[model samples]
Target: MFRFLRGLVLPEAACEEANSSSRYENLFKKLDLNEDGRVDIAELHAGLKALGIPLGKDAEEKIFKTGDSNKDGQLDFKEFMQYLKDHEKKMKLAFRSLDKNNDGKIEASEIVQSLKILGINISEQQAEKILKSIDADGTMTVDWNEWRDHFLFNPATDIEEIIRYWKHSTVLDIGDSLTIPDEFTEEEKKSGQWWRQLLSGGVAGAVSRTGTAPLDRLKVMMQVHGSKSNKMNISSGLKQMVKEGGVRSLWRGNGVNVIKIAPETAIKFWAYEQYKKIFANEDGKIGTVERFVSGSLAGATAQTSIYPMEVLKTRLAVGKTGQYSGMFDCAKKIFKREGLKAFYKGYVPNILGIIPYAGIDLAVYEALKTAWLDHYASDSANPGVFVLLGCGTVSSTCGQLASYPLALIRTRMQAQALLEGAPQLNMVGLFQRIIANEGILGLYRGIGPNFMKVLPAVSISYVVYEKMKQNLGIA
Candidate 1:
């Protein structure tokens, strides 16, 4: 029933619990603080933390509820042993379910066939990729011992429990909106966590955008007007805005910017799902390459549909104070003066930027996450919030660096009509002008403000999402 289990392995534990009673005893003793010969919740947490197996409050409670069979508040040595024994039993059963030939070892073909029997068809190549992940020693197959060791410390009691561990991760709106949207399990859709997570992310994005609107506007201004004759540093730019509009104009187009988040997120996720289905093989599964392709296409679809808003945001961001009343007024004037095509002025460069931006962002984020889980997967594979934030920031910054010039060109295109004496330039012409006029470094005109907002925007979004999720009773 849990289709997400098709490829995923459990928490990578170091212990090799293969009917080793002494090993189990040694583990129990480490957790049984104060020599009580029984492990309490506090002692369990401390022991696990020492072993790099940090647990949230809910995870600890679930462990006690499942392992403490006598309704006692603590776990005795027997209870601890039973927990491991039961966990091992579950792992073995999963392995057996996939080892269709009853060959004691699991092959890629068996995994694909097993999942197919259960109506979750995946390709042999996809199954092989999954096989390589858990296959010890590059044997390309998983024996009982190899399968057992992969999940020795896993707290899940069954397939459902195992996948439930990943549910917490789906809500993290990591990196920027340009990064791929997190995919939800089928269970998440049925359990109603998917919509809640989206809502939480949407609200977080709104608040974070609102909080950092000034910096965003300034970045747009610097991109549009920063040149040798018109040198607009952050300080001079903000002072100019304040001088003209009395300190309130800093967030000029924030309303439109915030309004676009809900639709963009909704469309992106919807389009991703559709693309995933459309690109899936005959068995209704796709590999990593196909997945990325689908994700990039989905992002393009969303950005294309919402390109008008992009143009509006650029216009308002670079517009003079009281030039147009608001987003609607700005749109109306642009429509009258420049026709409907004006709203899609920067469409080409914006779409082109998404390819490099989403590609590198997704690539680096996956690489970093995989490296972390492979090398440092301790008691739980779930990364700490700070660790996740660090990974997201680094990958996102790298993506921005790769695609910054295109983004600058897009902004320039959007604001070209409004700029007096500005020549009409396509994406390539604008790039050439910037490089020729301001040197190569000119391609990164507003990079300072853009980078400055990323950390706080990401941090604020994360904090706000957590609070909103709690308030919405997502747990």
Candidate 2:
């Protein structure tokens, strides 16, 4: 009997279209209570009520007035299906129009255009308002899935209703929505600002120095003697240094790195923010391409100012023994030994690498943060510690992948001082040596350590900086 019943109920051909049709038919039958093949007022009210919606007499009257096309005080299944199909068609058309690139994705630019066409003038604030409403993944893009789920799959058929629903959605009300406390006084704000600046400086410097240290050591080892064996590892390299020069050798040129970090990060962050603000909507949100451009420009600006210090740091880090005493002595010796141009020996590759590295890093971080929040914390107002950590990891990975080759070249150029009477290696010489001697793989020798250094260093830096800013109420 059960088998017979199942056979009777289930269709033989179970294709997607068949399943969808079955679902629609089931829905129709469920709504058409009393086996009447039609939905009466009582049946509609009961259905709405079952769904936990209050459909009082007044609400029923309004629904009947709009949905009852035949003026029969009832809804036949055909009429109801027609109404739903028409609304779905309209929504699909609207979605297609908004996805101007026809890439099946609605970008922020498309949203801006769509809003304009809908007769809504979107100011920067208004754009942010709308963007925050629809950007489910926080990637700042409004792909079809996000648009459909967040905007279209609702009983609110009109644009106004959709907007209203979005305005109240949990996604839009996250971290930035809460009201400031009355006890947050002016003195507290000023003190917080002071501490924030200090913290930004300290954290930025520490992260920069730490990230460069491993790379500095690896570059020196490779330049003085190529990474032919397992001795290229950090532990092995340290052991070699201890045997030759002593414990102090490991910290070679650390002073230059520490000193350079402050200016490098200060300039980089400041420039990044400025460029982001310029290209972004006035409310300080940007699209993916805009974010990339802004970050690249910022990196270029920062690297230009500090590339000389980078060269000096690398030179001091590498070598046999006693090439220079410390950061200051290194600078003096480089000036005396090689011309001032020696300080920028590998400027080309370094500058080029900075463009992709910074842009990809920042963009990936923001994109990952949005993705994690959307997927894991969609109902919450703030991302937890894990989300921030994941974002940092993603950002570091993208940056390192894009810039590893250039990093190798820069290291080689800087460590060229180890070679007896070797002239300053330019971009060409560095590339040739790396290719001819070690094959292509030589260029990515310390990638594992590079990623390890970057991931934690960048992750901690950003997480700390963001938390500090949030705690201090400095958006």
lDDT of all predictions: 0.75, 0.57
Q: Runs in model 1 with CA error above 4 Å?
A: 1-54, 60-176, 370-383
TM-score per prediction, in order, is: 0.73, 0.54
Error of 2 at 371 (Å): 4.3
lDDT of 1 by residue, 113-229 (tens): 765443234456656666665665578788886766555655554543443332213233322356666676665688787889899989988888888888888889999989989
| Residue 406 displacement in candidate 2 (angstroms) | 0.4
Candidate 2 per-residue lDDT, tens place, 1-475, comes to 2122123332334223436456446556756768888888888778655544443654465456556899998888776766655655666666786678898776657665665443233344444445565665567666544554343224444443333211111110000001110111223345565446445545554555554565556545654455665446766766787788886676676677667655765576567667866886764445556655765676678778988888877777775577666677878888888878888877788777866665565557656644543455433323544555565456656766787788778777766765778666678887787788788887787665555555445554665565555555542
The whole-model C-alpha lDDT of candidate 1 against the native structure comes to 0.75
Off by over 4 Å in 2: 1-198, 207-216, 229-231, 269-288, 366-374, 421-425, 455-475
Residue-pair clashes per candidate, as listed? 0, 0
**Root-mean-square deviation (CA) per prediction:** 7.7, 16.7
| TM-score computed on alpha carbons, candidate 1 | 0.73
